[model samples]
Target: MSERLRLYSYWRSSAAYRVRIGLNLKGLSYETVPVHLVRDGGEQHTPQFRAANPQGLVPVLVHGSRTFRQSMAILEYLDETWPSPPLLPGVARERARVRALAQAVACEIHPLNNLRVLQHLENALGLDADARSQWVRHWIGEGFAAIEAMLAEHPSTGRFCEGDTPSLADCCLIPQVYNARRFKLDMAPYPTIERIEAECLALPAFDAARPENQPDAA
Candidate 1:
């Protein structure tokens, strides 16, 4: 029998959205257990949720008896375990390049604009709404500027971030693009990024993983 897959995710969490795209691309069927991040002081802070992930973050994947945390790690695990439609390129250097592109968004951009960070900006640092929005846009713009150049100048760039097929980079990029749109960031400056996002979203797998399409979306 195949192992059961369960995803503990928040509807709007970009990290969770990345995992969802990976799973869908790999043609894996999984159950989504919604963890409302905002209602009632954030359900992710609950004892039960924390027990699943001590970090109190969403996009935790339970496959059989194994539990995986972090979206990028989960994507790697899925690609390794189910190699049919690989997420990373087969060549060593290509794989590294793809991962670096993925991390450029996952590590550098997403962290600064995460929900908790924004919440802290408002609650702890006492930044007003305009300031908070500016903060989000500033970091996204800074990170995207580099990514746009990387993609635009690189010969490896295709319909997707790497080559025509979607990779881990696309999984990370798409969600960050979604978050950018949510914050009303000007996407015209990053034409290459916008083009890649458009290509990815045109595919069924990427479309299915959208935040608004999730089971727990409001």
Candidate 2:
């Protein structure tokens, strides 16, 4: 039986963008239901969206009878349910390494720089625009520094984060790079990171997920 695949997405959301790239890479067709994150203090907080995802986040994938949230979780779900064009490589160690790299960006870097966090820092904590910019740059720099060192020193690194093919690590890296660029962070320090990101951006899947191409992007 053919299953229904639906993605509850926010066009400019880096997390949702990640899922879109994964779906594209796997050649899975899914309808994009845009959940406007910015309108009316974020539609994700509304009762409608909350019923779909208790976490009230976008990038919720409804497949058949199942629903999945969390960008990395959704990617893994897609890969597991449809094993062709695998996103993670063989070998348990290699998979773990790639997952670690992804989490470094998704968990450590993104949480601090997300829209809600920035808004909280400003409207709630009284941080000025300058301070907020610094906050964004600081976390992005820290995360990218670690990723840069990993790619530079680790023998596992190749054309992408792991082997020649783009893996989950690359999926996570590109969105974070996009976020960094949006904030105008200097990229010269992370040559390998920048190089891999450029390579990923050249691919159509990653290009399609870019913020500027999204419906909500201004």
**Lowest lDDT 10-residue stretch of candidate 2:** 209-218
Tens-digit lDDT track for model 2 on 1-218? 27989999988788998898898888888888889988898999999889999998888999988889999999998889887788999899999999999999999999999988999999999999999999999999999999899889999899899989888888888989988998889999999999898889999988987878876677
Q: Candidate 1 lDDT (Cα, whole model)?
A: 0.95
Question: Candidate 2 regions off by >4 Å?
Answer: none
TM-score, one value per model: 0.99, 0.97
The deviation in Å at residue 63 for candidate 1 is 0.4
Instruction: Summarize candidate 1's per-residue lDDT along 1-218 as a digit string, tens digits.
Output: 28999999988999999999999999999999999999999999999989989999988999999899999999999998998799999999999989999999998999999989999999999999999999999999999999999999999999999999999999999999999999999999999999999999999999999999999999
